[model samples]
Target: MDLDQLKTFDRIARDLSFTRAAAALNVTQATVSMRMRALEDLLGTTLFHRGRQVTLTDQGMTFLPYARRILGTAQEGREALRRVERGRVTLGSLRTMVAPLITEPLLRFQEVYPGIDVVVTEGRHTQIIAMLHEREVELGIVCWPNIDPLCLDLEPLVVMRERAPLVVSAEVAERLGPRPGIEDVLAIVPQVISLFWWQVEPDQASALCRRARSSVELPVEPALRLVERGEGVGYFLDSSVREGIAAGKLKEISPPEFGELYRDTALVVRSKAVLERPMLRDFALELAKDFRCMGRVIEDRLVEDVERAA
Candidate 1:
């Protein structure tokens, strides 16, 4: 009938002692007894058997589970209220991967849940996964292949996919000559500006890096700019260099060692997370939405690369 009386009865049933339950509940033993008596009166049944020690009678044992369920429901309702007031969310992302993968989905989310505050932490792919394991962040936008397959508690939603193109500047291509062998191309480049990746297939890029005369790791834009200046050969997402390739600023190079290059970007959450706020779940879905070859830079560039290579 009354929540307080039900709560008291549940605690007393669990502890099997009114004095112990009262101490646990921060109430006097008299108050606990009174609430238990009121609950028993409402139910019209004797709850506990009292002889030498306190123990639940048949009716009390029957009511125990139901009381626990009610208390659980109440706790959930309270937590939901607190979530509405707090409206906080944290996301982890790689420093170089945040541009097209992160921007639009967040814009769409803000249009709907403007009151919620989103904080982002930028780190390497390994660091972001570490943040998830530590429960320092609620969600991560990461390259899926880089994540360890053995990790059991990760839930990944593939948001978008783009091609990784092995590319050289037009000047570099001219100097190296048309359709040069992989070894000749490898010899000419003094420095290879490698870009950030989740490293699902590290061997593909690492092999090239190892074979090249020298290598420097850089982010997407800087890598692209340096490659355009003919600093050396580089790998870039097709979308990142689509405009350059179309405008004759960059050229695609195919080497024998590399095969089938693509990267899947994902929104990752802990498998055990409840996602109590709709904003969190909806944002993940938004990132996962299917955006084909129209406005998306990745799709547009992929088509161009295919036609040019054809």
Candidate 2:
């Protein structure tokens, strides 16, 4: 099957919308439909229901994981080949962190390293972490206190503080009260944390965010969607919720005991050997500086992430 067809299928399956997938892929909706048709023909089965709200067929459900894997492998191969070609660096990023943490720095990095191409692959928090460990990508940035590996096992390249807010859809916050307290939020809110964080022990912030009667373990993108729809509450990086809060779609809810919690945003690599190149080290430094600059508030606490493995 054509790699382009598989890529189109993967995007459509994830979004369940041909138009959105086409827009994201920088293609026309007609192109998206054609690709899907070509893929279905090759498979000899219909993959999606093609409704107003697209639903995957049984054939799609059975083939989805394998298609995802195939696309992943194709990406891996492409990146591997690019690296072998010289002056190229692949960075894995948590999808939520990209717009907030690295966009500006990445643009500047591209300017300085014009010869050294930078490619960023964004996945859910856990998938990005898995890519780092699997050696599919050279580096990853993840938010901490929620999706941490406990103690420096992930090879810390840089650590900076991020303001994580316990947030709810405006409707939920309204139900809680004009200015809801922890007890009120806990009575009404339902947590929507990433599935990767399901195993994360309840940290101080968790008490406020996850004290709800109901919960969901979804990826950041979908979790944000659910929160936007007023389906649940979640602790999101302050940057992640800024626009929604600004638009009155979501609101920050301070706990009775605290106003906000900090997440240690860690920039990590697979191994020290990967950073042996001075360029990688410089790139990490650039991103760290950018993040610290963008950190909206300076709290009393400063997180000192262990840099070198002990």
Candidate 3:
């Protein structure tokens, strides 16, 4: 009946445990139980079947969507008011893509809206999705093919796709010789530094991971560092390793068998209703514009590289 009761119900339903929900909501377990009991009494039905494992009853399942919608609408109203009065925008981004995707675009956003405050929270895909669902952030940048916005009730605003290249330290590249085949590269250096930020298929990803004699999984920054030290070869977004490649510290290898791999980064919002706010809309537009410009620059460079190779 009340927002607090509804929020408690929603959280409890999500976590499937009153104790866990209490921890997440920063309240006592007894308080969570009291709120849920009050809600179930008000509705004149048993919501959850209390037992060793917590499971939603038929009535609870029916009410879950309505509760989520009410909570979402309430949060959106609060955000709208905050946007009008304070000009604050919050964004969530994948930790690996932050440098390549966010830095320049954020600077551009700041230049256009100097008075507005922008907060960026970086996390992996699941964390970012949770932030969006909980209304902790107004926007999120996540890897595509890895995330399906429609299924998660998020609206995609922009998708920026870029090449993912196989790279190694200059020393390793020199050892393999120019125009090395996949077999030659594998024979010389069998260890691969794996980054799972982008994957077209689970099986394909697994196969790549298993190809090397040995593999070590790491986050983007650390993996890049290891590759730079000639610890192992890495498959990374071109933008992520561009500086290193240009500085002669890293080399990009394009073995004939590896072909081309691309990664897509998308900007998404919880709902299209959020975009009705002018300030948020402006910030979103600024980010999209910057990303488009970056895509063009990358494309131009690719064309130039092809012409020179020819």
Candidate 4:
């Protein structure tokens, strides 16, 4: 039977009088009797004894607990739907972008919305794009310059651009000397630690691969460690190398021949997903704000470097 019938049965069972049950339900006695008749017809059993005094039948007592459980579960579902604060936001990010770009914003998000759990899945550009296509993640952080053109559904919410500088250890920097060219740096530290996220032209990529055949290719985290330990020189995002350079453990080699290299890390979401799920929109907005602030910080740092050099 439906909720109305079950409710009427429960009310009559509680009051042990159809007249009082109708009063409690704010319905006429005839309506209550009609509901009872429909329920009994559906179950093929009378739920109440009709006499001078009303009383529940054996079947009615047996079914009461099950009906109450159904009503309770329905109420719980409604309550859950109404709770705006509790939810989960799944994010996919490049391993390189996570620590430098995502960690702080994520911590701040958690502080503000403790009830909303965030699950971050780390992957390469292709993998993150695949996750978005498959509806596995709502948000993603990826290098934007040479992204896959096929994924036209992905929308870039924020693009944080920063210089990508060649980082050398203090000893390697001394050997290369000030204003060292690419060839000079390569001669000194032949095996450059390459970052997977670097977006370069086909010609440049071929030349680097041919010249630095002995170079070890690695992701950002391990590559950073190797560079810091004087294992090899690394080309990294400015934000990634900032602390090391400030600590005097790493030096930036800005060779004019190599020109100015920059990386764009974008926070992207599936446009359709954002439209379908509004919570993702809210999360994307907050995250975009954080990345904008970070972009300003990087800009200020670059300005300070220029002034100090001049």
Candidate 5:
């Protein structure tokens, strides 16, 4: 059927309610119902069961995947056309890292190369590497672990330390009185830490044993907020928490025993693929420089600001 009909069906299936689907699609409930009926007639199969509560039928269950694939293919086709009209780059990353570094640079790059399109996708560490391996995406930046067999290049980047010390709320700090051991603090505090930190030195991981009851794996922002609200402590790249630390929403809870946790950040792609596109090579170089600059800028500013306050 028509694209609109496909769109309508997808929305309905997702929400499982025509009324809600219509609202989401900016159409009337009746319009949604009518579209589904038309789609069913064209396909000669009942797509949904009509009752007090709307539900997908066996036929609808079978059609769902095909319908989604059709819609996805259409969207990709449109994006491909747009890329041809204008050069394009597809980049993938873990969402936690995207906002601070990748997003702004991509936006700025787009301004310079207005003809170039940048498509960004967010996935976890493993998924991102798999995407890169498949060449589904031109580039991906991820925490340095599980590097695939592809001839990919890597660069190291660090989070700048925050100027202001992040502090727990009065209650939290008091809950674990003076000079609480890492294990004690961890037992009670809510903490967010990167997955790679565990790969650091055992002492470093052991040090956190007191500060973290158990590892809490979450996207960076939410974890920071939880720490800010005194839900628990969070471990983030020094750079990611700069804004939060500056605003006095968070404080550094120094564990008496602590050490450096390094994550090897890299640009991943097939080495041979680079030979084909000069622009691609240029982009990779610029991206590395940008990451370095951002880290330094934040560190310099943080040190200067903290020293001035001192």
Candidate 6:
């Protein structure tokens, strides 16, 4: 009936030794025995068999799962209390992907709920998702292809269509004897920038391979930097390169489809994570709304495509 008594019984059952359990609980062996006996007597069940080596009875085995759950609930309650006192919402994201994907929505959410402190941890995409699934953070903004079904609750939101362009600095291009073709640029750039090929269909994959001169596998943004600085023509997402192009630091190559690569963004959290915290829930909703509104950015283009058919 008493939690302390049940706790003592649980520890004794786990260790199979009253002496060890007593030492663990910082109590005397006789005190441990007394608590266990009291618990067994109150429940009218003989929890453990008396012998040279202790073993659980059927009733004790049945009680084990419940005991673990009760202790877990207590720990969770204590942790939640600590989180409330701290007034912080911990979030995680892939290092390079979070800025253009979630930063604006996060800022807007902060404006609406200024009292909630938002702490962000950045790592690789896989690491970020693992932390989210493990409840290390409240949420994760990820740009991965597909998520695992095991331990996560996902909110899929297409924040933006990311397109990487094959870019070259004007100064760099002018220095070359002849401008490279798209396939040629890709092959050669990998040598200088290291690149990951995405969205290249099987039909195009062969062509890309034939022309690839470089074997470096750099991430998108850094690859673009290599291009802009004239090290090589490299691929980079439009969101990252747009500013540089506007500033006349980079120029897009003639390959029309080179800028078409894209990935969908999603918010991920542990399946059991409670979205019950009012301020935290509010922030999540605001972030979802901001992402949903992204579709409106190309509304005019959709209208034009529709009218042209008419």
The RMSD of every model to the true structure, in order and in angstroms, is 13.3, 13.0, 11.2, 12.6, 10.9, 9.6
List residue ranges in candidate 6 displaced over 4 A: 1-83, 144-153, 157-159, 173-180, 183-210, 218-222, 254-259, 271-276, 289-310
Best by lDDT: 3
lDDT of 6 at 97: 55
Mind giving the per-residue lDDT tens digits that candidate 2 earns over 73-116? 98989987877677777788876678777778777787778778
| TM-score per candidate | 0.60, 0.57, 0.64, 0.63, 0.60, 0.55
Give the higher-TM-score candidate: 1 or 3: 3
Which runs of model 1 end up more than 4 angstroms from their true locations? Answer: 1-86, 145-151, 159-161, 290-310
How well is each residue in 1-310 modelled by candidate 6, as lDDT tens digits? 7668868877987799888899999999889888888888888998888789888999999988888788778888988778678687877866555555568878888887777668788876667767777778887766644345544455443344445555678675554335555655544344444343332223333344456664455666666666777767655556667788898888766554333444445555453234556566555665566545532232112223223323
Best by TM-score: 3
- Candidates ranked by lDDT: 3, 4, 1, 2, 5, 6
The better candidate by TM-score, 3 or 6, is: 3
lDDT value for model 3 = 0.78
**Model 5: per-residue Cα lDDT over 1-310, one tens digit each:** 9988999998988888999999999999999989999999999999988877889999999998999999999998997887767776777776656777786676666666777667788877767777777777786766554344552443222233222223454556677777766666666764635333322324555455444555566666666666767776645666676676677665556656654443445445544344255455555545655666544322222223223333
TM-score of 3: 0.64
Clashes of 4: 0
Model 3 C-alpha lDDT per residue in residues 1-310, reported as the tens digit of each score = 8999999999988989988999999999999999999999999999998988898999999999999999999998998787657688899988866777677777877888887878899987878888888888998887764454434676666767777788989998999988998677777777887777753433434565678789888888788888888888867887788899999999999887667777777777767666666667767766676666544322212223223333
Tens-place lDDT per residue, model 1, 1-310, is 8788888888888888988999999999999988888888889999999767999999889988998899899998888677657786778987755664567877888998888877778887778888888877888866664545434466654445777778888988887776676687777766877775755546778777777788998877788888898887867776677889999989988766567477766566775243445667666556555333312323222223223333
Window of ten residues with lowest summed lDDT in model 6: 297-306
Q: Clashing residue pairs in candidate 4, if any?
A: none
